[model samples]
Target: MASVWAITLLGPARQRRSHNDDDHHTSKEEDIDLGPEPCIFTSTIPAWNCRNLERLASKTVSPLVFAHVRASTEGALADSNCHPFSRGALMWMHNGGIGGWKLGVKRRLVSDVGDRWFEAVGGSTDSEWAFALFLDSLERLGVDADDEVRQRDGFGHVVLRKAMLRAIERINGFIAALPAETREQGDVRCLLNFAVTDGKSVVCTRYVSSRTDEAASLFFSSGTSWKMQPSSETGKGAGKTQLGTGEYKMERRDRGADIVLVASEPLTFERDNWVTVPTNSVLTIHNQTVLIHPILDQYYNHTPSFLRSRGFAIAQGQTAEDRKAAITRENSAAALDGTAKEVAVA
Candidate 1:
């Protein structure tokens, strides 16, 4: 499993705008350090004092936060490769791998996007290129992805959501465009779990291109507060609450969702507090309200009670369990390598 590292924090708004006068909160960039190790130093993470992490988390307060732990499958371990990549206002992070990358999907993705989006790419990961494709998709939709005004005024939830769905559609197009033999070269089945935001509204997806195969793990937890419990273990600091390496839970005093967290896996072992965002669905968070929508496409399985084979997801270490009905479905289900039995539509 790749060690979790990268994080993005959107601070309180710095200026007020009328379009978003409902609550009137501005946004700014707070402290952000992503990667297994910060790039500015001559050392690695183990060399840094653990207290530094505690202090950083304690002092920072942001409404929109994105933390990603990645194991590089396509790109090298450089700081620029750390996700939550941004253009003007849009920021993105992705989990899982792009299928058939080495064959021709990389070339196809690079050639498919416009020059503006192409020039904006700075890293060598399928994730970054996906961001570029997103930017390109936004541009093609007559929405300037880098428009300063839209970046500030909020990129309306519908625009952002549609762009995200289109981006995934574009990815599928590229993969499908490959030669039949080339497509079968590498693992051509993609696990596209993405988190994207325009500072205000957030859109996340848990999708695999195959109808019968499960995508990578994606679980979301929402509550009134993500508070720390009184710990039985204490540290040296007196009267100061310690940020444990493992101690937190979702406390729901009411139905209102004040804080929502989406991760490739659950943040804690509080199973009841978290809900699995359904596969091939989009989750949108606006004004702290979550709405889930199904991404109905050709790969979509219409069976409401269909159980996705978790073998592919578990093999990637994305999920802890293989939740399929029985192991006998291996011949009946889709594999991560892009092989699948025909999906019957109801």
Candidate 2:
């Protein structure tokens, strides 16, 4: 599963007040001094292990957070290859592959990025290069990736969205430029699920470069709080101590989202709480409002009934059901190819 999770807390001042030693502290002063302490906790350990995760999840509370558990189709498994790649005050993560990355596009992708961003890449992953591309795109837009001024001004949502789209466009162009023989022999479809934040606002996308291929799975759950629900069975506990056993729910007393989660798979099996982020949409979380915008490109299809076969994405991470679905799609594609060849001959 190519999953990413993120959360943003609107008011850190109100939260910090409890930690104040002075009883006479003014709320206004605290509010003015409020700045987000953003950090991302990530593990390649299948989202289930790593006892440190459980300890941190229960204790480490932040205004914003991004977590990813990768099922890699392109990169190796190492600590440096983990998601939530950071540079300066900005943190970025991706949940998909750049199409034809190993097919000479890696050279072009790396060549396009400047030395500063290029040096920051510590891992040999396409995801890291994608982040570098994003940084390069920002620089081309006149926003310095390392500039203190832009960091203070905050890279606005528009800047982020533009850079992200450019990154995708560049990847698409790179694939399109590849030799026909190479393209035909390999997959040239891109699944670009990206999440980026400057510790103030978070932006994410669920995208595919092919018009009829499903991107990786991305689901989100938002509400006032994510609490552990009572276990259906009597012997189980209802807290962090219970770990994977206890179920969780999103409590929605109001329309506001005090807590938000985005993941490749639902962290807990609360079906009603999670919603599939539309296949080609950008989800922006600012001031606690979740706005989803469709990414309109040549590959985007407006038809509601159009279904993208999830074969390629599923092949990256196979389950028993996924294996069956992939076989079905492959057989169908083969049959269609045969029919088209016969028609051409006739």
What C-alpha lDDT do the candidate models reach, one value each? 0.74, 0.73
Give candidate 2 misplaced runs (Cα > 4 Å): 1-47, 232-245, 318-346
TM-score of 2: 0.78
**How much lDDT does candidate 2 score?**
0.73
lDDT of 2 at 301: 91
Weakest 10 consecutive residues of candidate 2 by summed lDDT: 337-346
Worst 10 residues of 1 by lDDT: 35-44
Clashing pairs in 1: 4-69, 5-69, 13-26, 13-27
What is the C-alpha lDDT profile of model 1 across 194-243, one tens digit per residue?
88887778899999989878888778899888876765444656565545
Candidate 2 per-residue lDDT, tens place, 1-346, comes to 3333333333332342334446766343232433333445556666666776777677866677777766765667766777778776677888778877878788888987899989989988898899999999889888887876556456777888888888888888888888998888777787889998876778898898878777778888899988876544345553423335566788999988998887777777567788888888888877777788888888889899776666666765511224665566656765765742111100
* Shift of residue 108 alpha carbon in model 2, Å: 0.8
**Candidate closest to the true structure, highest lDDT:** 1
Q: TM-scores of the models, in the given order?
A: 0.79, 0.78
